[model samples]
Target: MKRILVLLFLVLCYTNPSVAQLKKVTLEEIWSSNFSPERLESIRSMNNGNQYTLLKSNPNNLFSAIEKYDYTSLQRIETIVSTEDNSDIPYFTTYLFSEEESAIILGTQVEKVYRRSTKGIYYTYDLANKQLKQISDQKIQEPSFSPDGTKIAYVYRNNLYVFDRITSNRTQLTFDGLENNIINGIADWVYEEEFYLVRAFEWNSDGTKLAFLKFDESEVPVFSMDRYGEDLYPSQTVFKYPKAGETNAKVSLQIYDLVTENMDLVSLDSPYYIPRLEWRNNPDDLSIHSINRHQNHLKLWSYNVLTKKLSLLHEETDKAYLKIKDDLTFLPDDRFIWSSEKDGYNHLYLYSKEGELLNQITSGAWEVTKYYGYNPETSVLFFQSTENGSINRDVYSITLKGKKKKRLSSKSGTNSADFSSNFSFFINTYSSANTPPIATLNSADNGEEINVILDNALLRTKLLSYEISPKEFSTLSVNGNDLNMWMIKPKNFDPKKKYPLLMVQYSGPGSQRVANKWNNDNDYWFQMLASNDYIVACIDGRGTGFKGRDFKKVTYKELGKYEVEDQIKAAEELSKLAYIDEQRTGIWGWSYGGFMSTNCLLKGNETFEMAIAVAPVTSWRFYDTVYTERFMQTPQENPSGYDENSPLNYPELLKGKYLLVHGSGDDNVHVQNSMRMVEALVQANKAFDWAIYPDKDHGIYGGNTKLHLYTKMTNFIMKNL
Candidate 1:
């Protein structure tokens, strides 16, 4: 009998080794990037179509280089520049080539200023003579080489300066720039956070003129956060932050003439917001986009540099609000391509130089997610869209007239492309739920794979030794809409045994959680939970994007109402599954997702047993002006909309276990949100748990902070849910 049992055990181990050797994922490993896939970093196509440049770094020596590679051979042609060979050059992290490829700008000691703004010590390296010169003695922002490759323009201390390479002289272009009062050539805090504008300056084609925006934020309200660093006393960091309906920085567009040395402000009938500025193919003319205060009306204007006159190019007014994107592509012939949602879906439209409607370039029921570039040689335009499915993204090539639209990407999951300068070739990055990121060089004409750049085969092999669950994707009918969803069951899931269901979401406007892409950190955490016999799922509820504008904008004026309803309804529907334990349901999210989880626990108190919220905005009034007013107008105009959905007003209804967390140094969504929630819950005589990480930003990540936070959250889930 013992020999028979041993032989059976050996057979079982041979057939199912995964059961015996499968390793459970740990939070430390997740935060340590143990499962990270290899990636092609910072790929820049050279002016010559046959070659490209890659920023490669050696971690052991801390040396970095810009290596040139031939696209056809997929081999490194040469190291254009490296800190290892150049004694004068420090360890640089980023590099940008001049328009004529005569010089390259290397950025070193770079530090982030805000979400999308950075300041760094810069150097210009001449390719011909192998000469390197510092652009400024101090750190600068958005340094760009002139078209003639003679001068470099950058922003320093809110002021604009130009470095002349020929003369080796630096000239200050603007002197009125002051901290928290006036800013030149760079975006203000609200503009950077909302309109996604960082560097607010552009160089004209002829290199004789510079167009920039000046922000007078003297009257804007100031917000302060206490940064409890490793010091004796905490320091306060303050900046101008404009809330909804608050006074915004007075923005004005200005142009400087190098030949005449004169700077003049262009008047646009006192526009409320100057969001965009670009120089047309004709250096004499500049294109500008201005929006009104309510944000419903947008006007495109053409300003002549010599004439100093503005002409109305095109005007668009939407009932809801218009989103500002950097998709305005100018063709060589002066015609421009723009994307619009006039037909209920975002499609590309071609307009004449005079702003006359020529034709709709691309139209469909689905939306164009990204507008790549128009190849003038073949008149073929490439873009990524949701035509495959709302949850999936595929690359497609279309003509100028919108006919002959061909799908370039063959993958069914998330696929993005970076086209070469000549558009003859493109590098495609593809990823799916079951696959790590795979980058391949392909033909731009028909998307034929030419060479494999990186397949992440090692990461795939390492993951095979772990107990990873497959992310099953499907659609759920909830609130009369087919909502996209993905669920992860336990590795040894049994249909007869019930498991606790945890619903996760962001539920913010134009945010998607149910994407069919490779796993993120949160997805790994969900897998960890699934391995512990818990079912994890994510649903893209109403107010989420990729569906029609009507479905996404349905919750406008009421930010959290329909989204909360959809989550609660989806949870109820998911609870009906035979394998789900309806009584022990839970939810968690961060940021906007954090806001949703809090509301789900309170408003849907009967459905959710526990909730975890991280860096949540308890009220829309706490958000910035451009993002909040676009959807919910203002707190003064929409008082009921702000108060009715706010969880602060209904803290008495909280009947489940709740965990609230925030970073004390969060400038985006201040800690006042969590503090107020704490006070409200205390006043309501409710029991809950909350934590505040000192000196952490909205992301609340640095070193082992994310691991600690996840550990706390994991323990809470194991105990409560």
Candidate 2:
């Protein structure tokens, strides 16, 4: 009888349709996609000028391979180097090819030191003998090949060192480099974040000298965070982080002679921040871009290595903060191209080697979003701008004299191009809200698609299987200004039955939340919300970028005031819709948007019913000096601006449900910001839900962590809002 019962159960399990259950959707499947795999990022043209190499990841092999592609046909001809083929070498996250293409520097085992600062183990791959050589047994930062490709220069232990590939000998250039005292060949935390500089050393045109920036941060106060691990005792990760009104690291320029092993400091007459440095066309001449403490004044100076003298070439000033661009390209003739907002909009400028302004390359109400390199042979400058609309980006080209402007991308959506070595071909990455990202090789002169690299057809088909809503793009009028907004209604949306609303935003200065772009991880979560019957919306408030300088800088001396007003007013108007539930409304944001959301819940208490703030700055005084002071100046100068607008000062106004989330290891906006707000709410006897993720950074992404966070947030919304 028991044998018969077991046989019957086995038959039922195999034959019955409902016996086997459907698989619960894993976060990995929801986040990952089966798009066409190809070599893509960190693309650079070989010195031969006919070939280029791209970093390729092989999922099956679980390793990275450097593949070289032909310039004409855009075909991956061969794998230059593959970590899987070697037994001794480890897999690298990133790599750089030397000028001669004989050696490749592989970066692996990377550990984040600070914002934009990383330490990694480097290995040199030799092509001739198929040998792999380790540059250093220890981790290092920003390893670069010499101009001759014979030696590798890097920064380790806060000092500069050069390793000879032939002799396997190491030479230390600066012995005075110490933590919080003398930093050689690398930038500090603030400079790295604000200036976007990582590698501080520059190789001279002839490979005879190296120029670097040394930061003296002894006077800077140290900010420490407790790291609670599984170990018995918690560790401390302490570093010098300058708050809004705190002291910054003193930076200076230094030059190192490779032949003599001698280092000397370059003297600049004015006190300024050396944001960028590069070797010019002349072997002995180097260009440095510096800004004042206020960041409104900028000066471009040339340093002659032979004479050890500095000459100011050009100066740019504005009433508002000066924008830093990566388009400072030096021409073969020593002339350079730089972009500035001095004309109220970002435009390109051409300057002579001696600081004479030649002509403006671009001018309009729109802003240039990207500056692709200039084709020196053809004299064409490639760039992407918002000429079509502020939310859209399209590629364009103009001559060096600012004449004969031509649009290279014919697509109406977001189109970005990565040109090849000889400017004959370019790889275009195009996408829109309704479409998945598509990458294709196209002719640079005429926008004709040649071949498709990634179409993401399978993912799109899978996405279509679920109930999804279209992202309805519209404009809202607030404070006599038109602001862009996008809304996603419920799949089974009914105009007669009101539905709850959830608004999202990232209201940082020069930021755009509503754009014609491809879907991200956040979009998938939003789709889940839409499927569950919720209205998702986002608005680009004032201070968002790509509009113009006036629109972005209007929040000067007032960070959250105008942004909160616009968002609240926009939400109020949105709630008037017959399909939206006015009473069941909520707002949530991360980082800057978190600041905006918290302020909205407090200041606009009647408008939004609930708000979730993730890693938010409760007060402007707690933010970094460069970002905060760019708009609000110093807290000493603007005390009321900092206090009156702080959400921590008005905890009593949190009338609705509030869920505050932050990561304990958020170095960008210190967890202190959220902790202070939590204390304030507790003191006011306000009930709220808050969670601190262990060892998570500002991004808050890790193994099942993002899914759990969103699930928690979803549960909160279902119960409260």
* Top candidate by lDDT: 1
Q: For candidate 1, lDDT tens digit of each residue in 483-577?
A: 99999999999999999999998999888878878958887888899999999999998889988788888988999899999999999999999
**Top TM-score model:** 1
Worst 10 residues of 1 by lDDT: 12-21
lDDT of each: 0.91, 0.85
> What are the per-model numbers of colliding residue pairs?
0, 0
In Å, residue 39's CA in model 2 sits off its true spot by: 9.2
Error of 1 at 28 (Å): 1.3
Residue lDDT tens for model 2, 1-721: 9999999988886565346331222334565532322324667887766788888776566688888888667778898888677767677878887877788898888888876789999988888988888999999999999977899999999999999988889888888889877789898888788778888889997788998998898988888888997999999888888899889888888888888877778888775688888889898898888887778888888988888788998888878788667889989998989898878888899999898999999999999999988998889989999998988899988999999898888777799988876777788898888787888888887768888877877766655445657798999998888999999987667889888899999999999989998857677667777777789999999998888889999988888999999999999999999999999889999999899999999999999999988889899999888778877879998899898889989999989889999989888888999999999999999999999998888988787788788888878887888
Query: What's model 2's TM-score?
Result: 0.94
